[model samples]
Target: MVTQTPAWVLNDQQGIESLQLADNPVSTPKDDEVLVKVHAASLNYRDIVIAKGEPQLPFFTPGVTPCSDGSGTVTAVGSKVKSFKAGDRVCTHLVSGLSSSSAPTFTDINSGLGQHLDGTLRKHAIFHESALVPMPPSLSFLEACTLTCSGLTAWNALFGLDGLVPGEGTTVLVQGTGGVSIAALQFAIAAGSTVIATTSTEAKAERLRSLGAHHVINYRTSRDWGDVAKSLTHGRGVDIVVDVGGLSTLPQSFKAVRTNGLIAVTGLLGHAEDQAAVPTILECLINACTARGILLGTRDQFHAMNRFIEDKGIKPVVDEEVFDFLEAKEAYRYLEQQKHFSKVCIQLE
Candidate 1:
């Protein structure tokens, strides 16, 4: 067993450039925890935010390791551990001990792996048994690591609330080719729902089609792409709109959904701008759709999503570029530039 491991730490500077690779002590797991030999860790938008020390996160522990989503093999288990043994493959849940059905509170958010607590950027990490779920059978460590955040959030958006399961004859509209949107597209198609995706370029549009999207809308060329999306659905509008662009795109999302349809507000990727002439809330009222915010998901949702991915042979889309563990800062910059197709990952070994 190794006594030390290489890990990336976000020093007091708080930015991609601030990440430092250091040799850190690796301790044995505690009575209720297991030590894992991490194989890969993946990036999410939130990881970047935390690395920069966002002021809103009052409880963020500075100089802590960063990254929430990871996949690893259990190397050792404490005496009290029972559900897992050495050599079992697992993926992390963002929060350390989340098992509740409700959305996370501020306290829960403070305990997130990459924020208030030490995260999985290290080559080895110790986690409570409840913080992990069995790895999906069909994916490699690189692909499985992404399920910890993006895949689970997409699942929660579509199936986590209101018992609304999208399947045959249902329609889902996903925004852009980011991690969560791409994940949602994959899950919806696997469950037999027709998907309409929006992207800026024809290149990404082709990729979306090849991934089983029924139609692709170029949001750049057509400012009113929402009307185009509705037209593709025969003026009936879509059943769900996975809205990642917050206020800048909410008006279009409202225009794209059917009456009482759902718009899952997954991210605020858009900048402040005059997107439309009307008030955003009025658009929701006019469209008669429910728009709610998403904050990743819970441990139980992570487990259920893993099972669904395994059962359907769905592998979350990972970017072609794989970074070495030492290149974590570069990975963060690449993701910040918004060039990757979906998830960006770094290998530990």
Candidate 2:
């Protein structure tokens, strides 16, 4: 008997309204590919933007499966594949396992799954061997799903700095309670850095603190969170700032970072409208700080980050809600609200 996979698909060129769950046949893996029976997939702001008419790749259409990060068991592998076999639990790297640059950050996303190629909002997905990372035994599929995109972005932002050592009293500022920032807090704190986290809601501040954030600032109430950050750092400013909250927050991030500090810019959910902040960013750079733009990360980096997580037993910060594959759209909606604390996951059979 043939199996069918139900996937949340965006079939129109306009908006999220066009997204629908459709039952499609499962695919066969190519010679260098393996089929993952995706167990849990997570949502990001990118999915929301892409669902609302932003093309994943240039000249790409609207109707593709939508989400990059997922964890699953290997159900099948092609003849040429040797690293994995049936029943192996795994997650895919953010890219298609291809390298475009040598820098720790700024790797080109050429054939991204979920954006241009088909993604893991379905029961199964076929990807290259290099895309797969072995899941740590300590993580459930739900927890493992968080690592691919959010975890990697946070890891790259904090640990990817050139001259910065892991320990030795470094301070890092993370904005918002979104997946990446939350993960950044966990990672930085674990690595012996002082973590300052910001949230719009006072209620979430406690949660952030609980997640190892040394200090929590309510961005809505505090007009100058940067000053608070500076004060926390004894007026020296933090060593790194995970500037996920784009242009609106970059100025504050500029003020928050120490001289020669690194500001790793990831998400622009807050700057979707005005992307041209280069002049202001340059001013910040001239002040003896480095601002690095980040996409997800390479497969090699993903492995290295996973190794750290495994060795440290650092679990991901997951929210209370878990949706099944059929309810992926609902999960995406909740992620957009930014009400949830950590990663939002969809469980696929």
> What are the TM-scores, per candidate, against the unseen true structure?
0.95, 0.92
- Show model 2 residue runs off by greater than 4 Å: 1-3, 55-59, 97-110, 272-281
In the range 1-349, model 2's lDDT, one tens digit per residue, is 2267778787864555667888877768888899888889988777777776564333334567878889999989989988899999998776665652333333234356677777778887778887778987889999999988899888888777668744658888999988999888888888888888888887788888878888988988897898889889889989999998776788788888889888888977665335564336566657698888877766667777888888888999888998877777678788877768889988886
Candidate 1 structure lDDT:
0.85
Instruction: Kindly report which residue stretches of model 1 are placed more than 4 angstroms away from their true locations once superposed.
Output: 55-59, 100-102, 275-282
RMSD of each: 1.7, 2.6
Inter-residue clash pairs, candidate 1: none
Candidate with top lDDT is 1
Listed per model in order, the count of residue pairs whose N, CA or C atoms clash below 3 Å is 0, 0
Query: Which lDDT tens digits does candidate 1 get at residues 1-349?
Result: 7789888887764577778888888888888898999999999888877767666453567768888899999999888988899999999887766554556665776677888677889998888887788898778999989888788889989987775568999899999998899999999999999999999999999999999999998998989988999999899999889988886888788888999888898887776477455346666777777887788787777778888887898978999999998889899999999989989999987
**lDDT of residue 302 for candidate 2:** 79
